[model samples]
Target: MSIKFWRSLPFQTGFSIALGAVLLTLILSIAVYNQTIEKVVTDSNHRISQLISTIERSASIAAYLNNDELALDVTRGLVKNDIVTGVSLRSESGMRIISGSPFNFKEESILHFPLASPFMPDEKTGELFIKPNQQNIDAQAKQMGALLVFTLATHSLMITIFVIFLVQNRLTRHLTDLANTLHKIEPGSAERLQCPTLHRHDEIGLLVRDTNQLLTAVQNTLAGERRLREYTETLEKETRKEAERDPLTNLLNRRAGERAISRALDKADTNNTRCAIMLIDLDRFKPINDTYGHDAGDHTLVTISNRLTDALRKNDIVIRWGGDEFLILVQQGHDDLQISVIADKILATLSVNIDINTSIQESIGASIGISLYPDHGTDPSYLFDLADKAMYHIKRSGRNGYFIHTPSDTA
Candidate 1:
């Protein structure tokens, strides 16, 4: 799972808090309980040592005064020490003087007298032996047991409440705020998460700081995407505009003619009709531009352009074919004679005097080439080629005239 997802989970957050608290509490409790158990064991051993000292003193006094009954009372009292589970009194001659509990005599009791001490005293002096009080230890065990239960209950209750409050007030609120912030983000709107400022120097604060940093990165990403989208739209629009224009003439170019011709072809071909592709070339246009100024040539071309449009149908397309040439696409019925008639009409239209500049009103004429679909050629390119060849043939034969394309001319 992602860090964000794990951080957002309520159970995981609570579990983390509880785990930390439990670990700390266990370490502390173990240390304290070990010390308490050691103190109890030490105190119990001290009480046993004092009882053995009193019994030895009483035994010495009884032997010195020759008081048998008082010595018996001292021995009985020595047996009464609650922690002393077993006891024995042995004389210097290795004879057993007294025994307590079930055993009459045992080697372990004798071993305890020496084992309980680090170093035995003078060889002649008697010593005292002590054992642990199982019953009293049992009572202390019950008490420690109760204390342990109380400590665990108190610590667990406090820890549970603390973890619950920490998760609810800190983690849950932060995650919920983050979720709401994410929900508010819009595709184009300039908005972002505004996490509330916190004063506590804790993990949650660190988490909030990191979250804000991440949101900042997200905001930058969104902004960049919006800019890219806008740039793409503008580029697309400019590309579309460029596609419709003629680079040289600054008019609707060959691309426009193709679109118009395709539509016209679709309509004319449906009814088994025909369309005429008229290729018009300006006569002596290169010489005019070379002798005069290019500006004057361009103005002449523009003048000729206007004349051509005035002579043709409104539906007819007039396209600038690069330098000093234009293409006129016209829809016509199945009549080859009509194509010739339109060519004549165009010739007559251009025969008039055209004002090139303020002082010069020159005569500009065109060599017309005609190509008909399903008669001249079947395809658009072939028909365009046929008309182009015819225009070249007319130019080769003589300037300022017209010609119709034939299949043999193409070969």
Candidate 2:
């Protein structure tokens, strides 16, 4: 048998009950047997008296007639009983007869029955002696004791069997089935435990109902908590996004771009790759704002920002480094030549003409400076400084163009 079966509620309870029943039966049987033996033995005197009374008439006639034949018949009749070992008959005329087993008739154990004359009521005839068969008496008592024990044991066994059956049928079976059903149900399930048909309105039914109510309460609580957690996470993500982005352009701010660039550089170093940091400053932003207004300047900045993002790859980092200045990171193992090609694309994209109104238009241009990773430096501060110096060189030379800050340029 499986360990589960042995460990099950019914099995354990049945085993305990069976063992207890056996023990109870044994105890009760012993008590009943002992008591029966003592009771039968204690009543031996009354039994012997009854036996003597039955043979009294026959014994009296034998003694009065002084007849040896009748006396022999009387002794034979009394000795036929298993409790009588021997009997002696004595007449007043000196007639005597001894019969059955030879036993020393003691005054203590001997039963004396006066054999009176059948016709003369007042006359004392003779005496009858009997030796009580002790072994036979003991045997009878033992027989009665054993019978009582057998009856008690049978009664106890039947009761035990019936009780075990009742317990298994009524309690354990239902409980085990309910447990199995509940085990199959998932913790947050819509399905509920069903009450047993026969046990409706009973304790078992009440238990199932209460348990389902608890499960419903738990599921509802879990659902509410889950929704709360998801809402909290979404709010945190949106807040972080807002903090990381430039308010006007929606591009990554300087600090957030730096963090992202640092992470990318770490990965690039592990992979033995390269990166390009490009810094760009607007060429004629102050003139555009002075010519139109702050509204025109804002429109120009927003347009330029969209142009820069449109010109870069998806993985490239674009940041609003400060007012009229942008920081861009290109980290795809691009060589300096490819980096120069990307810079030309950005310059072309920024030199585009923007529509200020239905009739009026604004021209926005930018000067770009670039630095390569691990060629000039690996540090973000060092690379950014080099890119800024390169951008100033482009500003001094002319606007609307790009310059790569080579290690030789530092010389």
Candidate 3:
């Protein structure tokens, strides 16, 4: 089954946006709760101080008259308010009025209000103390926090749901269909996508049209390029064969032959073995051209090449070294005896009669010269020169036998 790219990607995009909205809502809710607690505490403290202000006049009068009943009335009345937990009133006349939980009020939390003389405003008469209710303040703060969190969460949930719905129904479904259709299409085929009717004139429809055009262009270009590539490959192979092989005898040419001989010599050096390079020159080849025409001479060389190739092992390399000369590389030759055996075989193979057409028969004998790998030195050019000198030595003396080259042989 084909994997769906659009299904995974677009839905994840929607969820990421919705998740961000929800996380932001949570962070703001925490901050608002903290701020709400502080505001509630501040407002509760302010109300407690306001309560002390209200009873200041009554407490002052009580202290001036030294009345216990009046002080009690002021203290009890102040504590009756919901946010006030405790109250204490002290008079200069030694009268004290106390209300619920006044002993529990801490020094820092106590609210103090000073009472003055009724006639002399500067004269200090008495003081009143009040404690704000902390539990009631915290409860109110918690209630406000819950309401705010609920409102933010509800808004965030609604937005998240709307976003996911839009993505799955409006965006991802279309993209998933498009992806599935594209996956089925081969690159150079006639297949194409049809734009949805609902999404006509939108970005999705434009994309479909553009993609079809691109597919058509690719098919055309690939057809032309494939033909060109095949033609180029055929031409390249023909060119390589022409470079490496002789057209007349179909043997390896001088350049390819030299490389093959050098590689054989290198293998012999690596394996601690020996290789033999034999050079052959037809003793009386010019007479065939002079008597029977150059066409017969060409046929003579081709026949000689076939005979030489058939006489040797398949592992040996034979090369046409231009104008009546040929070179052979024998990689398995172990010593001078093996070299002599191979050279004698070549001389024997070439001594046979040649048919220059059925009416005429001619004999073109050959002189073979041999050189060993390390015996004649390693370089291919140097070995060929030594083998040439050996062939010339046979050509000068008896001109039918073979000679293995030594350092004393000279041109």
Candidate 4:
């Protein structure tokens, strides 16, 4: 439809064919013109040689009989012939006895004749011989000109016909077909483009085949990218879900706690402050589960979990660490009083009686130990272990309260 659209098509084999045809036509035309000129020049030289022979024969008769009238007449006859440009009759002493035209023969010059004939014999007049005395250089030049012009006309006609065929079949037609096909190919569509038929064994066929192969490869690559995009989206969602979950609680979880703590820690750690880890355990929890129905005890454990979670700061982390134990990660350790105050708050929260729902309401209490990072221990593990040991010591020392682990008490 448009010139720009045709130029963009990958299968532009037709333009190449048209260009090749034009070049070939030019070369052939030149060769034919040169050959025609050569032939005309050769024919002209042969004709001039024959005319010189006829003049020499007539002159030898006149020279033997001493017939001046006949010699002058033969010379005049040669001049009348259009092919002969110059003529003369010479004596043994080299004086011009007779001549045709005002043109003078300079010396014995015989350059135009293909071969110089020494003399001719005449039977009628009984003469010995007469030398060649005419040349036709101008006639040869005229003949070559006429032949060159004819060759040009003939070759030009043939080239014109060939160019017509190339434009009709090779240039305009094929390019139009390729452009239409290219326009039909929509991006990401499943539509298949049909390859053009190859009747001639030429460059066009090779180009068509290569273009088809490239298109097929492009389609397959696009399909693969689409599939990969969907797979990547699914993997990202799963990774985000994994990132938010805590393996132990199966609740809002530890990574969620870490996210909240990391924000608080970012502020606290920058301000040269601290955060606390509380190690908590149900006092006499193992014995109660061992003596009473373990199912009933599990109910009590669930109740204790709810109470502990409810007691902490909104930003705090509550995690179940194996049987009858929990760990609380708290932010708000700007002062030493922060840890003591949170421990007291948690102890007071656990003082209430919990109804396990499987039976009557039961009374329970917990021992909680407080520790601060960079104060109790520099690392998370160190702080957690020290806090756990303190809680254990409190449980051992008759339970139902909280303790801050001191170095002396640990020793």
Off by over 4 Å in 1: 1-24, 46-69, 77-81, 89-99, 102-130, 142-146, 149-157, 160-189, 197-248, 252-275, 283-296, 307-317, 330-353, 357-365, 379-381, 389-411
The digit string of per-residue lDDT tens for model 4 on 1-411 reads 455645643334445554565676567656765665556555655666677666665566455555668757766776677655455554333334444445533444332222122353222332222223234434454466556655655666676557666665765566567657767786656554454465335655665667667777888889899999999999998887676654333434554654555565566678777677777887756766776777768767776777777777566777665577777878754345477777887887776776655565666788987777657765566777798888877877888888887877643
- Highest-scoring model, TM-score: 2
Error of 1 at 50 (Å): 6.5
Q: Which stretches of candidate 3 lie over 4 Å from their true place?
A: 1-156, 173-227, 333-337, 407-411
By TM-score, is 3 or 4 better?
A: 4
Which tens-of-lDDT digit does each residue in 191-228 have in candidate 2? 78888898888999999999899889888988899999
Checking candidate 3 for backbone clashes, the offending pairs are none
Model 3 lDDT, full chain set: 0.84
lDDT of each: 0.69, 0.86, 0.84, 0.62
lDDT order, best first, reads 2, 3, 1, 4
User: Best by lDDT, which number?
Assistant: 2
TM-score of 1: 0.62
Sort the candidates on TM-score, descending order: 2, 1, 4, 3
Tens-digit lDDT string for candidate 3 (1-411): 765644476767786877798789989899988988888888888877776667778888887777788988887888789898888887776667888785654577777787887778898787777777778988999998888888888988898888878877777778778888988888888888888887778888898889889989988888889999999999999999999999999999999998888788778789887778889999879999998899999999999999999999887899999799999988774444377777778888898889999988888889988887887798888889888888888888989888888777555
Candidate 4 wrong stretches, greater than 4 Å: 1-34, 42-66, 80-82, 85-248, 251-268, 291-303, 310-315, 333-337, 348-355, 406-411
What is the alpha-carbon RMSD of candidate 2 to the true structure? Answer: 3.6
Q: If both were scored by lDDT, which would come out higher, candidate 3 or candidate 4?
A: 3
lDDT of 1 by residue, 1-411 (tens): 134656566767677777776776676667666666666676777777766665665555443444546445665676776766665444343423343564433443232332121133233323334446657766775578559746875878697877778767766777676666757666445565555566236665666567667767777888899899999999998887788877545556887777777778778788677788989998867876886788878877777777778888777778886677788888764454388778888988777776666877777788988888768766888888888889988888886888888877643
RMSD of each: 7.1, 3.6, 10.1, 8.1
